[model samples]
Target: MGLRRKLLVSIGLILAILLVLLYLATSVILMSSFSNLEEQLVLQDVNRALRVLETEVLELNRLLRDWAAWDETYAFIETGHPSYVAQNLDDAVFANLRLNLMIFVRYPDQILYSKAFDPQGNRPAEIPRGLYAYLTPESALFNLPHPDSSVAGILPLPEGPLLVAAQPVLTSRYQGPVHGALIFGRFLSAAELARLSQMIHLNIDVRAYDDPSLPSDFQEVRSSLTREKPLVVQTPGANSVAGYALIADLLGRPALITRVVATRDIYYAGQAAQNYIFLSLLAIGLVFGEATLILMDRLVISRLSNLSTSVTRIRTSGDLTERMAESGKDE
Candidate 1:
């Protein structure tokens, strides 16, 4: 091949290899990094949702403790005091407490009082039959022996899931010989879920662990909930990710699943950024390759071509005295 053609081929080959390497590195490393960052962000949002849910449970337990450890409540459980219910369990009381159901169970599983209320309307309602039936001698609330002990959990009632708290009835001082247990429940209604979602800035869903209607991806994530860390999974063909955490009942069985979903805006943004970077690199490579080829033509290939022309002229005209031109520049 002629000198200029050979130099062009050599430069083209090197630039092609470099460009391929650049593309591979960006695709493999940078893309993977962006994916991991997106996953981490989703995980962070899920963790925030988990923390908010935990705080709600804790608040319920604290409210239960306040009501259960009161002197009037202790007396009402034993004497069936009509004045106590008329005074304490009234509409204002339920509204202030934000409780849907209140149950006072005497020792050995006797339900002294059970009432359900609508906190929004501050009106009485029928307690969920499933919840009423679930409170038996074997229930965790009735089995508590210590006045200081309390149980808080999610329970799937016929109406819906409830965040329930139970505490052994005692004096306001948390003092002993517990007569029974006082239970409070807050329904996990649509309003409540919306409030929680707003608080955490993510879409949240609470479902029974064995709920058959859960999406397949959610079920797959839930299956991995045995792990200590929350399970995070990308929803198929969606621009969002989901995270799952198991909420156990008072008896320590997985009762509810908390799912948090967040969009992958950051991932898409990262991909855009990577594309920009790749384009910038490609442009730079093109400029660099062009400059390299121009310099080789001016400093090396041109001189070699001149030498070849001189040799050909000498061979054809039989004049060995012909000399080639030389530039002042060093090779």
Candidate 2:
């Protein structure tokens, strides 16, 4: 009803509105920023997974190059040297080198020698039935545009898929009237995938290009070769997210899909921080509002109240000569 009460109400309303707006703005901005940062962290994990897998491939290439460009391998391919096979292509050698398959092909598709091994079983293994049939003249391996250049890629096998590397057989010096091609392969087995997962502390999933069960994000990644960035998605029914990247074989065909997933620890941490900030701000607003109201009541509202009381008394008593007393130097 009076000036002091009206001023108190108006200031309280303004402070309350400002506090609400500040809280909403801070929450929205912080939540959005934290969401983006979590997405970036998922992306970084995916990139690290890709790098580790690529390093494995490069190592395979190096090993294949060494074996392919060896003098014994060249001599064995040319002359069927028994000693070379006896000394070098044994189970111990395969186990030590960690190779799943080794094939020696004499130029235009004549298989000089082909063998598959299971290092885990410590015994000989069979190549995927009919896989060699695809190595005919029309195949990518036999039809290499540059016969001298080396090739490495994924090959679909009955067991699953294999990472393969091939090189033209030459003397150890890498000189050649290329005699033939030598191939080395390693299967992408469960053990291998587990090893990779442990290394990066993320789950890894691999799918065939045409797998009907492939996730939508993975399919999107496979639809284009130029898509350098992975498709990231939050996992359903889990506190985690995944990023999908398409892997192409040496022939530039989408051969495999890889997904990297990480837990939402960072997201959870950000959320906790945001909640703490909101609560702290609310508490601060309450304290500030109380302090401000008290100061206003003492410094401004109390003085105004005294002036109103004196004016009212003069009005009621009909004393036109009466003067209101000054409260302090503030007047």
Query: Which candidate gets the maximum lDDT versus the true structure?
Result: 1
Counted clashes in each candidate structure: 0, 0
By TM-score, who's the top model here?
A: 1
- Backbone clash total, candidate 1: 0
lDDT of all predictions:
0.80, 0.78
Clashing pairs in 2: none
Q: For candidate 1, write residues 167-213 as lDDT tens digits.
A: 89998888968888988899988788899998767898888887888
**Lowest lDDT 10-mer window, candidate 1?**
227-236
Give per-residue CA lDDT, model 2, range 1-331, as digits (tens): 9676777688778877987888788778988888788888877877887787787788998998888888888888789877887788899989998889898888666888889999878899997774675577677555543437777778755567788887788888878777678878888887788888998787887777777777776666566534464355555435877777767766776677778877777778878988888788778877887888889889987887788899999999998999998867865
Q: In model 2, what is the error at residue 104, expressed in angstroms?
A: 1.0
lDDT of 1: 0.80
